[model samples]
Target: MIPYTLPEVLRLVWSLVWQQIVQHAQVVAWSLFRRHHQAVAQVYHYKRRLALNTS
Candidate 1:
């Protein structure tokens, strides 16, 4: 087994942790964007229906 120095070990761990954080963040952002898009579409449809009813 290759012995890693302290800094090297820390760097390896940090990279792994950072990758996990970035992946989690991407997933969260995508979900939020999808939800917001759905909400906007719903609102647009509701407004269109209201306009049709009024006119």
Candidate 2:
């Protein structure tokens, strides 16, 4: 039987952690982007409604 060295195990763990970090970052970025888009759309809609009321 063969055994993995300590360095090999550490490397594997590091790779998994890095992958998780990248995935979480992408999720957070998309969430923020979506929130920003929704906020902008709401502002535009509010402004349009206000203008219509004034006219």
Candidate 3:
């Protein structure tokens, strides 16, 4: 069996954690991008209605 030292194990875990963080950030970014475009389309269809609905 291959033996892994402590720092090696820690580095591996850290890499996995960073990957998850990056993936979550990508999902949040895509969601915000979609919402921004949706708001833009709403403005084209209903300018004042969108503002009124938000307020």
Angstrom error of the Cα, residue 26, model 1: value is 0.8
For each candidate, the alpha-carbon lDDT, in order, equals 0.92, 0.92, 0.87
lDDT of 3 by residue, 1-55 (tens): 7899999999998888765555888999999999999999988879778878999
List the candidate 1 regions with Cα displacement exceeding 4 Å.
1-22
| Model 3 / residue 18 / CA error / Å | 21
lDDT of 3 at 31: 97
lDDT of 2 by residue, 1-55 (tens): 6899999989998888765555888999999999999999999999999999999
Candidate 1 lDDT, tens digit per residue, 1-55?
Answer: 8899999988998888765555888999999999999999999999999999999
Off by over 4 Å in 3: 1-22, 47-55
| Prediction 1 global C-alpha lDDT | 0.92
Which pairs clash (backbone N, Cα, C closer than 3 Å) in model 3?
none
